[model samples]
Target: MPVAVVLPGALNPLAGCVPPFDRCGARARHATGPWASSQGTQILENGDAVDLTWVESAGAPVIVKEESLRNLWGGYVNSDYENACEVDGYAGLVTFGEPTATVTGLVINEIPAPTAFMEEYRSIVQWISSSSDARFVEMVREGIASVSMWDEGPIVRVNGPLAIFDAALPGTEAGADELLLVEIESDTPAPARESIGWIP
Candidate 1:
């Protein structure tokens, strides 16, 4: 069985559609550290390498949990914020998915604050809303809306299946901001072990 790892939205474009697992013979000689045969797993370094086992596991197609979705979106938001901002006080929630064989739990973090952090977050949300890709908004509407640590300080609760405009406000407790939350959910339940195969 062939495997492909599904990186979060932030890394997917750079990772390409197929797994980048076998790079040992390439001119660049990418190194994916250690293979754990017992667990039927391979660990790749954090760069652009892919893990076939991870891909196959995700290929099984299973529903992810709400908390898990929050984490995934939060992680992507943090990474993007870090690269753009460079401080721990700024972040954004891009998208999220439910728990599944491929992934589980919420991934959240504090990103370095950037001077234009709010603007960047607003731009990202606007981009998603206006993008031609309907799937982007659809996925977000399926799961719970997650707020970053920075956004959470003033928010008590996010609302709706499509909570794009109801996210908590960063400052001033009196009103909600225009920040939107995109939820990601799927009907596919967790896959059975028989449905997944391990690579040697």
Candidate 2:
């Protein structure tokens, strides 16, 4: 009917310009994983929400939760910390500050190449010699961040939680004292899935 109807308030087209699902409140909760662990989500808020996976070790202060917005709101250039950090599981953006590596690719122990082929086949030879138990996570490295496990020294404690073989690490330069190769081991068992988007 065209009869006059009361409205709660004048419908301002500008009102709710931000989509409900896209709108993020200042409040943030742990998206997933244990408190302050490597394999968890740390959500941040601006107009858009950034789902930052805690790529480093456990127990590191949830710094990004607070600091991420400052760069956007404060009208300052994004520091290297923000630039080097990986977002949305893409690689090639690992930095020394966070050192938490996240890759949106398949992580597996080994790739058993075709073994049924001829003995002289390159594929068969590569498959037979590859260690079935060898484990590694592959991701893109931006700028100078490289991952190598061959230069062995200590078990590479990334950001301090994920202990990859030393071969999987790039050497940190000297005088970078904060880049300590910790021998600490986390008792927390690995999760079945690579990522958890909910935190309680």
Candidate 3:
């Protein structure tokens, strides 16, 4: 049985209360089908249906209904969200924080939506931009808080429009393993796309 370690989220200290994935059984890790038809529950062998949200699968598909989509950001869904479905792979994320040594590129693996990549990048910018560089360093030391049950991946590297990462590229496959989400940060307010190269 695989063991899972749930981390505490930034705002929630009790975030790791969920049972480990091994205890939930294999079904919890490899869920199938759509969420809506399941009555929001995962039934165990004894016929007990648990709440779907608490399942904590790393890679699942979530079909947000039209009504729910309406309430998302600006009362409108991101154009990129039109066909989004993958469950958030980085839901209980452990952010690696900005690199101590400058790097040319970054890779944020296994995210659910294009908007999320942008949102996270924006958050890092908002945090670092509003404070002094010393404060940014302090925040890094305080470390990123995360839900204990999620995957750990690279933190936001920089704040670039999705285009720099070629997210909106036509004919690109959605949820493809190769479609990595990346960002670029720079000393300049608006850095050129070439400032940071995306390895993926």
Candidate 4:
């Protein structure tokens, strides 16, 4: 089922995508880490029913959740990812507002990573790092809209609790004042994470 985009506290949509047996079983040998596996069942963000399938592709070990995502969806969604942002323990993948309304991909993160996370991802991280204040605000909003972190594509991990960051950005003073966006949230105690979808 597609996870309702309704916010302000939605139950995790990825709750049962991966089975508990996959968590610790004979499958461990084939997986690079805890959950990023190439085989076994998975639930795409598009709301597709979880099912088993097998394939090969490069994937990163989510040291935090100990999972790997090497399915077709992983590649597709990762391709859409461009940047991310984080604040405190919240983060989200920013895809320039692409039409990911419901597509298959890695889990959207169940809890803020408590252990290691994408080393390079930050609230202001971008394909081309910029010093512009407006750009900074844009990045922050991207994180908030998507709402949470994940291996954006297999290389970077995104981070943010968007509403807060979005609210923090200056909406008015753009045409006036010497706009300056100084800092963005970085390395914080990983709170452990906490995401769905689908159609023709």
Best by TM-score: 3
lDDT of 3 by residue, 74-180 (tens): 10113332223221322221111124622222212222111111122232111112122233323432333322232333332233422212112221222332222
Candidate 1: where are CA atoms >4 Å away? 1-8, 11-84, 89-132, 145-200
Q: What TM value does model 3 have? A: 0.19
Query: What lDDT score belongs to each candidate, Candidate 1 first?
Result: 0.20, 0.18, 0.24, 0.23
Worst 10 residues of 3 by lDDT: 68-77
Q: Give the clashing residue pairs of candidate 3, or none.
A: 6-148, 6-149, 7-148, 8-146, 9-146, 60-87, 158-184, 158-185
Q: After superposition, how far is residue 192 of candidate 4 from its true place, in Å?
A: 23
Best by lDDT: 3
Per-residue lDDT of model 4, residues 155-198, tens digit only: 22323221111111112211111111222243533322232111
| Candidate 1 lDDT over residue span 1-200, tens digit each | 11111111221222111211234522111112221121222233323222112101111111112321233332212232122122222222232233343332111222100000112122121111212223323222232134222213111122212221111111111122221223322332332111111111
Displacement of the residue 39 alpha carbon in candidate 2, Å? 12
Estimate, for each residue in 104-178, the C-alpha lDDT of model 2 and write its tens digit: 111111211111111111000111121221100001111012322211111111222221111111222111221
In angstroms, give how far residue 163 of model 2 lies from its true place: 9.8
lDDT of 4: 0.23
